[model samples]
Target: MDEQRPAHILVVDDDREIRELVGDYLERNGFRVSHAGDGRQMNAVLATRAPVDLIVLDLMLPGEDGLSIFRRLRAESRSPVPVLMLTARSDDVDRIIGLELGADDYLAKPFVPRELVARIRAVLRRVRMLPPSALAESAVRTIRFGDWRLDLLQRNLIDRGGVVTPLGGAEYGLLRLFLDHPQHIFSRDQLLAQLARREFEIEDRSIDLRVSRLRRRLGDHARDPRYIRTVRNEGYVFAQPVSYEA
Candidate 1:
């Protein structure tokens, strides 16, 4: 067997101190770290270097903000690369927007280095834990409900008109969980535990935000959801009957 390589992480931030601090810390913790001062530098690194496993992006930048860079990354890249956003503590709106744009996770500014390491580990753990057999099986099966088809192998969500919607890692995991257990109401804690592969602090609102984003993707209205329904005083449920094909 070939030797497994350390995960390569790209740190994109305009702040020199922060970029160096995070890069050094992550490198000390066994990750291969690269630094970029802004979006242009980030794009150059991505274009020239080996494939990056994840990105630690700062929300605020001098030019071409993190959000715009993230949007472009998702739209242009051939594969999905998990993004962990760094935002100001008060920038709740930006945080939510980043999540909706398919960010894998986010941390507030002035965060502890240890906490950042923890979050990075959690995201990478989820990404690396997929077994070959499971991936093969999922690739052959496509789950269908209402007008949406979820290709297990490709991890793509296809609509009735055949437009493919992109999903973040957490979004895909949560949706698959719901599809696998249609009509089973899952509590906030239960969902969090299922999706969070490692010990990480996640707020209840984060779950709500992910569900909202998934609902929009499915064309399921929040007020009258045809697929994922919010059970009163209970957790959400997949309301539609699901079928699968291999």
Candidate 2:
């Protein structure tokens, strides 16, 4: 058996104090940490340092805000790197945008160090838990539900017309969880656990937001969802039968 390595983390923030504080904390908690002040510096670190398992990105930066940097990062990198966004704002606009843009998680400023550590671990664990078959190419190539087809190998959705819509990491995870157990009702708490989200995330409506995004991708309306239906106060259910394709 091979020895598992500690997760390497990149802290991208303009504030020196914050970068150092977070880097020190992560290092203390058995992670390898690298610091970057701006997008340029972040790119430099990414180019020079060892492969990073996750990134702690601050929304507010001196040049090229975190969102733009994230967009560029996603466009340039072949493999996706999980990002946990840090926002000082109280509003959900930036957080929602980050989520829609495929951020792995988000944290507001004035956050406890322990919570940050916990969220990082949760995100990395989700990435690490991908089955060997999923990591490579699985025997099951795609799953069909209704008019849409989910490409398991590429982690994207294809419509009847062959339009491919890419899903974020969180969206892919949630959709896979639902598809794996059709007709099974999953409460918010249950969804949180299955998605590896901390209890603290429920207050922020994380599950609801993710589900809404998925529904939009599937062209399923919340009021009259054809595939995913809400069960009043209980939770949501994937009401469609799924077929596997090789």
Candidate 3:
């Protein structure tokens, strides 16, 4: 998030009342807010307006659902902005899918506007959390492991086929931490201390969820993993041997 100016936020929801309420609340809290009723309007705002720092996307829409929009955004956008999914449904599956697909955070409906504001700040903080010196291993420029290459300068992952994959803020941070100390097991608390934004946390499940997402980007299966392996009650470890390149 840009500290010099009010962060720009795009609120994408079909309900006019909800959109107005959210946009007004965000503006009141010192944000530059824009409204979008659906995927089409959302795209238009993105294409025409100034760059948005974060997006407040609703999961349930009239034509194209929020998940589809999010997926396309990740695949198409060169610099994917942080996304916070707003869903009326209580199903864990929707939440998991959103997280795995690189959403910054998620909130359920009937939420207090205050809580939403807090989450939005937390997600933005995570995005700007890592400094250039955060990763000691990053001085090497590139880190290679398994069948993938991590361009530290670009802050992206690339497959052997040369396809690039974007990593969310937390995902990039967690992966860098693991690469910095491969074969070293880090308990959940240790990992949390390294990555926590010092903001309000929903639960410890947040750490687990982020680790799972990183593993997915590394093409590591949760059950039969190759790169990041579960250490049972101990926590997790980046088992692969990482090599550095200048």
Query: Which whole-number lDDT from 0 to 100 does residue 11 have in model 3?
Result: 95
lDDT of 2 by residue, 1-246 (tens): 011888889999999998999889989999989999999998888897478888899989997999999998889875778899999857457776776566777788989999999888766755654444434345668888899999998989999999998887788888987876566566676676656642223333778888898899889976899988999977888888776767
Runs off by more than 4 Å, candidate 3: 131-246
lDDT of 1 by residue, 179-219 (tens): 75565565676567656643334467799988888898888
C-alpha lDDT of residue 237 in model 2: 80
**Candidate 3 positional error at 104, Å:** 0.7
Q: Tell me each candidate's RMSD, in Å, in order.
A: 11.8, 10.9, 12.5
* Worst ten in a row by lDDT for model 3: 129-138
RMSD of 2: 10.9
Q: Clashing residue pairs, candidate 1?
A: 139-153
| Candidate 3 lDDT by residue in tens digits, 1-246 | 458999999999999999999889999999999999999999999997488999999999989999999999999975688898998756556766775565767788979999899888866765554343432443568888889998888888999999998876677878987876566566676566556532223247788888787877877876899998989887887887776766
Can you give the TM-score per candidate against the true fold? 0.58, 0.58, 0.57
